[model samples]
Target: MPAINAIAADKLVRLLGTPRSPAMIDIRNDAEFDAEPRLIPGAVRRAFTSIPDWAPDFGDASVIVVCNDGGAAGHGAAAWLRQAGADADVLDGGVIGWVGSGHPLLDTAAVPPRDAAGRTLWVTRARPKVDRIACPWLIRRFVDPHAMFLFVPAPEVAGVAARMGATPFDIEDAAVRWTHDGELCTFDVMVEGFGLGAVDGLARLAAIVRGADTGRPNLVPEAAGLLAISLGLSRMYPDDLEQLDAGIAVYDALYRWCRDATDETHDWTSHKPAKSRVRA
Candidate 1:
């Protein structure tokens, strides 16, 4: 059993893709981080020595502290965060344990530069349907939990991205860093780029995203359903931001279903239909 103060890595992995996921704080010392240079999915690096300075900024959300191990560093950081009136816990066994258990880790070097507010900014076409909404969900859930999104008119996407130093995605410009690559949707590119393809649920979710975004519904069982909902969401909200906000919840449900309940089935029958004893 996990200790009262620590959460198991498997349980945390289940929570990582949802909006209710705790804020993951990597408090590993510089030397240790320099060796691996990757991050737990959705985790942000914070100097362990400066928890007092940074702890106050996390008041809006609960926090999880990760160190080299679930030892003194993480436990102490969680203690300090709790003292500061935030719900906090240490990741049981930290980075090593996460790796040991074969959970996916994001390649932090592929992350875009953060703005002054310490959030990644991404610009994409307004009136998003599938891929655009899915990409933001991936970023928020696994890449940068605090990433910012900017939705502009389709014609102005590249210009706004350039002026604001935001990465433009799901647009059709050869110069843009995040456009479609051949047959793959932007969602597929992101999954490959971030090294998240190893995640079984995310891989399944990616196939659905690709099929929905690329007009290839035959590729995945859920693609047609996702495409319908995404298109409906686009029509429902005139404000692009509102549409994206609502779409996040849709993807959240799909992700959780993929992760936890993919094999589960239901029917009206209390037990398997009487093997049909057909008038033998």
Candidate 2:
């Protein structure tokens, strides 16, 4: 049994990509981190000794601390965070447990460098439709919650990425790692590249995104609906960022439905056969 103020690896895995997920603080030292460059999805590296100072940065959100093992560092950081008046917990067995449970961890070393403000910067063609929006949703929810995206002209993507130290994605180029690969859309590429593909819910959403983006709405029944909503959203907001803000809600709903209600069905009436109550 785990100690008080500690969360089991399986429980944390179930909460990984949801909004209810705690603020994940990776407190592993340099040697511990070098042993495995990948990180728990959406986790940020922070010095365990500095918890008393930076713990408040998390505000009211619950925090989870992790180390190479759940021995001293994780417990110490959680204790400090609790002393700072925040709800904190230690990963029961740390990253080793998370990994041992077969949960996907993001490969941080493969991502682009962060800006001085400590945010991953990305650039893509403006006026996004499907893959573009979906990729950002995945990034924000599972990679960097504070990641910055630059929507620019299609012709300037390479230039802006080069000059601004931003990772260019969803663009047709050899250097971009988050673009299409044959039959897959950029959303599919991101889901696979970021280790998100293993999540069944995300995989379901990726299939829908792929169907809409690849001009094959027949791939999934929901693809046509997604395309329609995406087009309407593009027309509703002239500003790219505003459109993205609105789109995020739509995707959030879809993701939850994919996770929890995919098997549900809807009909005009709850009646069956002779029990029909609402007009035929």
Candidate 3:
């Protein structure tokens, strides 16, 4: 049985990629981190000794504290966070337990530098359609929940990235590291770059994104539908940010479908009486 105020690794995996997942704070010491520099997807590193300073940043968001062994450091930091009025729990077995469960860990080296507020800032072409929207959704949901995006004119992407200290993505510049690679879209590159390719549904989602963004919707039936929705969204909002905000929900549903509903099928006949249903 798990300890009080502790969550098991298996249970945590179920919540990791979803919007309802708790804020994950890695409290592992520097030595422990340097030894194995990977993180649970979406977890942000925080110094356990500085818990008093950062605990309040979580506000009322539920949090799960992680350490090297799901030991004292995790429990202590969680306790401090709770004392600060944030709902907090310790990971039952910490990073070791999570790895033991065969879950994928994010590569910390792939993460870009954060700004003063600890949020990754990205600049991309304005009036984004498919890949642009999908890439941001993946980053926010799996990499940095508080990541910020700046949509600017195509010609200004590199300049804005330099001036604003934002990473430029989904552009054709030879210097940009987050753009397309061969046949894959930016979303595919990010999933692989972040070590998220092995996560349950991301590979399938990446294929759909690649297909839709590359005008080869035949790659997956869902790709065509995604393209249609993305184009419609692009037309719906004159403001790029507004379109991105709306596109977030679209990808959320697609991801859920990829993760949990791929095997399931739906039709009006599914609810119809067996006797009344048409026999093909």
Best by lDDT: 3
RMSD of 2: 3.0
Cα displacement (angstroms), candidate 2, residue 263, comes to: 1.6
What is the Å distance of residue 211 in model 3 from its true position? 0.7
Displacement of residue 198 (Cα, Å) in model 1 is 1.7
Model 2 residue-pair collision total: 0
Which residue pairs clash in candidate 3?
none
Tens digits of per-residue lDDT for model 2, 174-271: 76788999999988888878777777599899989999999999999999999999999999999999999999898988998898889887676543
Candidate 2 lDDT score relative to the true structure: 0.86
User: Candidate 3 at 222: error in angstroms?
Assistant: 0.7
**Every model's TM-score:** 0.92, 0.91, 0.96
Candidate 1, residue 187: how far the Cα is off, in Å: 0.6
Q: After best superposition, candidate 1 residue 49: deviation in angstroms?
A: 1.7
Highest TM-score scorer: 3
* Model 1, runs deviating above 4 Å: 270-280
Error of 1 at 142 (Å): 0.8
Could you tell me the lDDT of residue 125 within candidate 2? 99
Q: Write the per-residue lDDT of candidate 3 for residues 17-59, one digit (tens) a residue.
A: 8889899999888999998899999999998888778988988
